[model samples]
Target: MALTVDKLINDDRFCGDNVFQFVAFLPFALLLLVARVFLALFLWIASIILPNKSAVRQMLSTLACWTFGVYVKTKGTRDPRCSVMVANYVSCLDSLAASHVLGTISLRKWKVPPFFASTLGIRNAAQFVRKQHFADCPNKPVLLQPEGGPTNGKGLLKFTDWPFQIGNRVQPVAITVERLFTNVTVHRQSDARDKFPWSDALWFLCTPVTVFQLRLLPPLERLDDDDNVFAARLRQTLAEALEVEMTEFKWEELNRGSTATRREPPAELVRLARQVKEVLPRVPMRDIMRDLSVTRSVDVTITNFLEGVTPFTPEPSDAPTPSTSQAQPRYVTPVPTGVFPKSAKERQLSFQEKKAQMIADARKRYIERHGLSLALNNC
Candidate 1:
């Protein structure tokens, strides 16, 4: 049976959506890029001369929204009173998408790259602060991603406590993008392969019209509230509003994708190769391995690719169940829940605490499995 073009186009995951996007909007998308560059050049010149940022910001914001054909659906405007803002990360485009609506203020961090230094310096919009100086920029509100990294819009990762620690009214901004077959989200944890933040931002060119829904919720006051508890509750509020499940995936997992810093391939890639081989056996394993370039050896590659490769055992369909079967899957209770009672403050445990606990637990288990007797005997 010959596979027709129509049959091939029906697979939304790969060629189908891309082919349609290319046919419909590739030229227009290229034109938009040209226009954006021209506008950005003009904005830079105007800023140097006029030194009026509000006007420049408005123009840039308008250009970004128009160039992307962004459709913004908001619940409420950003609270003017709040000095700290926390938003759920969707993609690199989230900043541009929110700029027009939210009026982004300077989000001071420890340090920013030289490339970002000038761009963010337009209105002295972004500041650099060390560990002791988060409050250095008192005029402008600090924008933060409590998730610490991007995720597929369908879910929310664990939230960090940076936003709540500022001791200001924390405004929660929940943003989501609606796409057909192309996922515009730049999740570092996933197999989607864009290296830099700029490349991730420009990925919107793959789709025709990107629809972003930016919702601004009421600000939460830090009155007598613990930072960890506040951070957790704020995350919960955003997760609920965004209609996405709160994921256990940590921020460190996301940073594993940073080519400049990270040394290892994401564990997700290995799982993906296994799933791909199962469903699409015709797909080339060599191609996948080459793209990842994590391990060269076939045996090691296969071991990583297939996480659970065990020796084959015969199973007779008519055989009776064994009474003392240790072969039955050993059920392990969930760490966070099992250790802490429901009535306790487990839900309030911040990402940092949970992460530390997880490391400690892993260490304990390792020590138990391979006892200290070996080291003592060697001594």
Candidate 2:
């Protein structure tokens, strides 16, 4: 399917596109955010105290869903025979909703706190393998998001093959998340590029309500099909179910696009670098420009330079003067009044002094050459 980057990823914010609505809802959103912080803390501590499979933990999970404004509705029954459940990634809470309804352990690739992952039924790849290897396994099935990352719910990303390789029969679960007041479900813009999972969670708290609809499809047996074919078929099945187009776009492409968008213009970078150079005259312009490109803030670049977080070689100052040919007619040149520093550090330290002295010497020369002093005397 031919799909643009905007169709695959959400480029909007939680505050939304309407300036008037954003301003009207700002106070309520802030209040809700502060309350959710405490509620999340309580849920975190409770998850730690209680066992993963305990009834109390389950109740806490339900309470978390209610408190955080997450409502999940399941349409079809999950197959008991399938060990692996592949789903379309839509939001950070996809696993949480699936785990609550289907009792499935979602495979996580990113590093999160142990309790946090446990609370959300997220397991690392190693833990997933260990669980599959061990004789005593939990009754819950393994949930895998083959898309590797979340999208805007408008399209399905190409599925990876490893999830299909895990088991012969895989269940396809289609999850659709909808939020009130804003079109943004997951952040894919350049500004929130680095603040992922946390940013998503914060938006969830800010939003009044988020509804998740999960449709569980029947188990598909691989039979004679290879991993790639099996994965493609499953992806097509999900696309049909979700009523969205299947795109060849991957998470890597999304990351590259966001990075490209984050890059500042050349003029902006130069301006920021000059500001940093003003504060740190000893720091080379090249180093300042490099750091400014990444930080994109004059204050941050200056702080990084002062903290010695940025390592750089001092700019070269001492160079041999060009040799003149003896055969050429040479005119007598006046000796320089200002002293030149041999080292970069010395030059940086005495730059202002040298500048002032040069200006004074130039003024003196102009007076002598043009007879300005004689004119002043006559006046």
Candidate 3:
């Protein structure tokens, strides 16, 4: 009798820790089987029909995550206009947290398959794989976790070929899951179901993780640099962010110019927009201006900022969920979108208010600094 490749691979888990894990994870495995079926059916329908399919997908993803014991919180601020975003792969759940934090501000079409294939959230994320020129498109921003596969948040891998080309800013994201669930071993680099983490039943059922840190690293220095150089800079930033050692990989660095800055509009960019305005006719000036904005905020701050931009968000929605989701077609609510401080004295109060705020901040900083110094001195 001859052993098939599948048998050769599945026949053993090197440590036989595989057996212990399988027995221990029996409950999770059964749950995953049931959940996968349920989610797959729901997501399939959503992928085909739900009008705001992304939201539906996110809702389901969040719900599934809640079912598990994982929840997330973002930590820092991100730039408003930095367009492109990427991150390392830890678990499939990272997709949900990323999308939720990014919200509608980032135009997200479902891209990755297998990991996110079942969710409507990744409906068209595959399109991002190409090197397209997206200068002033009104659509939501795009995101990618370019490894296109999962790995322990260990060493870095090559990113997809976009960071150096797209006119929008490319921001890197860091998701920290306290305990990792990854394949302990790779055989021939083939997709094997018998792997350690991937084999876990609970891995299939997406769970909301505790302490989801959407750490947005600084924007890539340049979008037009050599792919190798651009990737080097990107990996360098991600490693610094997550504090992981980088593993060298094949790369092509290009000398694309810097389109990553938020201020100082490029002359050609302005000219191109002008040409489009002439050729296209009656494009909204405000919308075009919004398109011209720069990007580079981190996930944590971006989340808070978008909430601030969202009109009436802090006050709570004027409408209910199922109802409001239908009525006005929610655009990405901008934090501090259109609300201006009251005119005259109120507007004048801006400086006084900022000064007061500065004083308060200074005092707090002093207290913290003094307290830390006292502790060190005591030690």
Error of 1 at 182 (Å): 3.4
List the global CA lDDT of all models.
Answer: 0.53, 0.70, 0.46
Over 4 Å off in model 2, which ranges? 14-18, 130-134, 183-196, 261-379
Q: Identify the leading candidate in terms of TM-score.
A: 2
Better of 1 and 2 by lDDT: 2
Over 106-152, each residue of candidate 3 has an lDDT whose tens digit, in order, gives: 22333334434344234244344433424433344555666544444
> lDDT by residue for model 1 over 1-379, one digit each (tens)?
2111111111122333467755675577677777666755665565456544666656656655555556677788677777677888766566666656666643323233432323342122233342334465444555677665566665677776563346548889888877654656433333332233554456454455778888889888877778777788888889888876776656555445333223444565666565434322333655554433433233333343233222222222342344543354222223454454364465566444665454343433433443322111110
Estimate the overall C-alpha local distance difference test score of candidate 3: 0.46
Q: Which stretches of candidate 1 lie over 4 Å from their true place?
A: 1-24, 67-71, 106-140, 161-164, 179-181, 187-196, 205-208, 255-316, 321-379
**Using lDDT as the measure, what is the rank order of every candidate, best first?**
2, 1, 3
Q: Which 10 consecutive residues of model 3 have the lowest summed lDDT?
A: 250-259
Off by over 4 Å in 3: 1-25, 46-49, 53-58, 64-70, 104-120, 123-139, 158-160, 180-189, 192-202, 206-212, 220-228, 250-379
- Top-scoring candidate (lDDT): 2
User: How many backbone clashes can be found in candidate 1?
Assistant: 0
